[model samples]
Target: MQIAKVRGTVVSTHKEASLRGAKLLLLQYIDEEGRLLPKYEVAADQVGAGVEEWVLVTRGSAARQVEGNQTRPLDALVVAIIDTVSIDNRVLYSKKDQDRK
Candidate 1:
């Protein structure tokens, strides 16, 4: 799994039948220090994360392993909406702090 920022939503009117009702988000990968990377991807949203929120994402085959996503065609999936991220007792990102920005 990796941390990423929800940049925006992806709307596809001609996608596969199984992905019709699924919510897809555009994510920009973030490093451990909470800096954004140049890489970007679209992920299935099971956690209802909003734009600008930090989320935990799983990619590749593991993305399809999440419950209802087993039969869907997904290369990535948002597994959790991040509330706080810390390392070495130092807070790197906090939902409350972000909201105040």
Candidate 2:
């Protein structure tokens, strides 16, 4: 699993049958310090994460392990919505803080 930030939503008029009802989100990789990386991925949303929320991402074959994603053609999946991220006893990012802004 990797840490990523949900950037946006993806909408497709035509797609595979297995992915018909799945929600897709655009994510940007972020380091533990909360800095965004150049890398980005479109992932199926398994946890209903919203835009700008920090999320846990599962990639490759592991993404397929998420419930309801087993037979879908998904390479990445958003598995969790993070409320806070802490490193070395310091809070790096907090949803509560962001909500105040």
Candidate 3:
């Protein structure tokens, strides 16, 4: 899995039957320190993640299985909304930052 930031949503008027209720999103990969990394791609949203939100994504066959469909035609999928990310006791991200109230 990799950390990514949701850039935007993808709308599809027509798609395969297996992907009927799936929502696609554009994601930009990020590093452990929350820094935006090079390369960006689109993925199916398994969890409800919004633009600018940090999300956990899986790729390849693992991604397809995450959505509960082994035969899915997806290469990537957002599996979770990250609440916090820590490395060696250093907090890289906090849910508080996501709370824009």
Predictions in order: lDDT: 0.92, 0.90, 0.85
Identify the superior model by lDDT, candidate 1 or candidate 3.
1
Name the TM-score of candidate 3.
0.86
Q: For residues 1-101, what per-residue lDDT tens digits would candidate 3 score against the true structure?
A: 88999998788878888887788899999887778888797898888899889999898887877535678799988889999998999887986776764
**What lDDT does model 3 reach?**
0.85
Error at 8, model 1, angstroms: 0.4
| Best of the candidates, TM-score | 1
Q: Model 2 Cα displacement at 19 (Å)?
A: 1.0
Sliding window of 10 residues with minimal summed lDDT for model 3: 63-72
Worst 10 residues of 1 by lDDT: 62-71
- Sort by TM-score, top down from the best: 1, 2, 3
Instruction: Score every model by TM-score.
Output: 0.92, 0.91, 0.86
lDDT of 1 by residue, 1-101 (tens): 89999999889899899897899999999998778999999999988999999999998998898778889989999999999998999898999999999
RMSD (CA, Å), each prediction: 1.1, 1.2, 1.8
Backbone collisions counted per model? 0, 0, 0
